[model samples]
Target: MKHPSQNSSPSLDNVYRIYWLLVALFVGRMGDLYVLLSRRASTLRTYAGDTSLPGGKRDPQDHNIELTARREAFEEIGLPLDPQKVPLLCILEPFLAGNSLIVTPVVVLILDNTLRPILNTPEVTSLFSHPLISFLHSEPPFATEPEMLEMKYHTYDDVSSSTRPGKVRLHRFMTGRETGGTKPIFGLTAAILIRVATIGYARAPDFEVNAPGQPSQEQRIARALKHDPIFREAAALEGIDPGRIPEPSALRRQVRTRDKRRARSKL
Candidate 1:
């Protein structure tokens, strides 16, 4: 499986190369396309018991971001590392988490859906699956139980970002107990799927994917690389020059134009 360049421009390669953390969105079809998810072990210090994709920080032995994602998935959920069984789809742009970790989402298609999960009990408590396309809609893929009929499938709030200059949208998608477990998929997880679905289906979402004035993910990431101390330290360790990160305003304009073209093409 070939890993696509994380950035389009050669100059931004080093800037984007410092993605020390990654998550694997294991996409498979069991009728509707689905992505395997896991509940983080409650014993862990950060985001314990929260729902997340199978991934973790890059280890010294992992050769690249793709390998880092696959290795983490294998350790956390027993996902096969064989390229034949699972092949790379595409590497989405990096997202800066509230904790200051620049996480790259590595998407992979699972050719075999029958593979059982082998949970790393210390790192993951349980595993579940959610429809990939559901993230793009306001309703669940199937009929909901009477009690859960009142529950919303997707929602978000316009919130301020400490690292980025402007407001950002924090999305939340409910995956009910009967559907997958009690936890809702929000934050980075929700944002990732919205993008994956948009690409996979080649359709605009039923609702706006971003807030009115939210900065593009690229803009936010560029801001973090330039201004955040933790991101700066990670880049330095990677021998990356923060000076090479594109200006936030330039990225914002680029993203806006690209998004407009996408929206128009869909019409």
Candidate 2:
């Protein structure tokens, strides 16, 4: 399944270069499908006061992203993830964060739901989780369509002038049963979850299909992004021309037709 936003990410050439050293892991409880998440410490500067999956920068001791994710999960939450029990589901499409770090999301499914997260204070302030069904249900928890929120950055030597008044689509994976201030997920996290819901949980994805007749999944995703400012802005950030931001309608149709052709071929 295609992720929420991979096509039109911004160019981070001028931004600070941290390399591919960071990773996040979606740790799912096998039976209930609840994914673990941590609330970033208020003391931190970057992505401060945001909720995110468990992960950290890749250490020199780590060989790959999988190791990095496992290590980070343990360090951040003290969740001892047995490599044999908590199996890696997939490596999501890598993306560049606003901070200029290229991040890789490692999806892992754990055997039990009895998770007692010990937050590594200062890095993580708290812990919480919502079921995958909440996102999949599409009625109460998360909207049928992703929500867009305006973004603004204090222009530093690294930031471009165009990024001002930046607007991005926020993925609100609210727990229908819980009430409080909304904890919205954005950018790479949103993109990864959208794909995870559809692929890992066997749930219908969240997107809008513009075609009149029955439209394929590809067409739906393309149409959804066409209306998503985040997608356009991200692509533009990548230094792609404005003309290349929103994908053309004809190309969406072409992709839909080709998908059908491949299906028929297999049949």
Candidate 3:
């Protein structure tokens, strides 16, 4: 209910110049449940890989930020939410991307899951939803400072609950890895988390990082490229050169086609 713009502290003014650039965000929440969509890169070559949310740059035709958020959600995730279904809560303060575009996130609530997502393979790979309560409960223990950024991580105390009563904790972390080093989920994701936490969600305490093991999701894809015969065959059929890294657009199309065929056969 708190507007992100109205809640901005004086300290944030030092880091970013507040521009009145209007970009909209759709915050789809069902009861205590919120919807967050994760996107996998069609290929490991794209800039934003394995990130969350359905959003993009604003279009000239958009009348307002709300429309832009709805349009992007439908285009990217195939979830066609009616404008009437999206209840406008409040506008968050605009955040700047590295590209210098000022992004305005518009928070909204979606009470039902009636619409099936027909993801735009060119951008999205998969869509999954988690309970808002879970997010409200799980705490990310560690934070990463990539290069020169001075981001801080904070811990939260427990709040009382009845259904699954326990203390809820939360920790903030950098989202992506650096260019020459390991990637972390920084940038947009970090910004979103910060906004959500500050807006109202109760923070959870931090936990220890899990032990490192096999190759990560991205690494697994890379390994498959080297060894998977199925991928090789698919690449050949598509007239794509396996030795050359495929463009994200081309790879996404192939994945979408494959997924569609699989879905039809199941039907």
Candidate 4:
């Protein structure tokens, strides 16, 4: 008997090709079960010590953003994500790194826990999984320099307003120190966490979620800007003033509103 979930008679002609090539954001559960990989050499750390989802830059060969994420996971952590195991849940804003690399994140649902992952020693030192709920726990603030950069956004006056107003936002990236002086997750990891928090909050019910000893998001961001090494490096690299980035909270709010509207449409 054919499984009902499998579309055996998939047709290309009926497929609607929406060329919406915007940066895609997604969320993935670390399988429903909690498991942690043994840490190899504690001394060797390159954003590989902590437990995290497997992901990386999108390769040019990927047919779509989803393919890019799946490929990277397989290569870095040795998890062969079956196509059937992943479902597209949401899209997030694009995150730009200091080096100008644009990242698109995709969230996936891991249906089973029996699959063992073979960690790539060169890329990943260990592998582990924790309940998504643990992310709510608070941790002490770590110290690091805050990063200042400019961000651009469009503002709409009203629902009926046709003209879109473009403005610059002063944005800040929190350093590892602000969290509790523990080794900070910065660069791509930090950016990924921001997107994850936004998506998680959107999907969660109205309730209070807190991290222990960690400062509020706003405060952490301020501290990051104060200690951001990139901001200083940029100044020396270009010999130009590394001013503060623009605040995109208004734009983020608009995006979240749009997400809610789309969610309503799905019902």
Per-residue error (Å), model 2, residue 257: 11
In model 4, which regions exceed 4 Å deviation? 1-53, 137-191, 201-267
- Each model's TM-score, in the order given? 0.81, 0.58, 0.46, 0.43
- The residue-by-residue lDDT of candidate 1 on 1-267, one tens digit each, is 112244333322243344432334454534667888788888999888888887765555667779988998898889989988888888888877786666788988888767788999999998888888888798777667787777777788888855567777888887776354457888888888888889988998898878787776777878888778876775665557888878899887888899999999999
Q: What C-alpha lDDT do the candidate models reach, one value each?
A: 0.75, 0.54, 0.47, 0.40
Candidate 3 backbone clash number: 18
lDDT for each residue of candidate 4 in 1-267, tens digit (9 for 90 to 100): 112233344221112111111112223453232222222324555433443345554443556667766776777666565756544555554443332233455665555445566877766665533333322223312222333122111111111112212221222222222233232233344335444554555453122233233233343333233335543443333333435533345435655788899999999
Question: What lDDT tens digits, residue by residue, belong to model 2 across residues 18-94?
Answer: 23321223445365566666677878987786767776655556666687778888888877768666677777665
Off by over 4 Å in 3: 1-31, 44-46, 131-185, 202-267
Clashes of 4: 35
Worst 10 residues of 3 by lDDT: 13-22
- Full ranking by TM-score: 1, 2, 3, 4
Model 1: residues >4 Å from true position, as ranges? 1-30, 178-181, 235-246, 253-267
The superposed Cα distance between candidate 3 and the true structure at residue 237, in angstroms, equals 47
RMSD of 4: 15.7
Provide the lowest-lDDT 10-residue window in model 4: 152-161
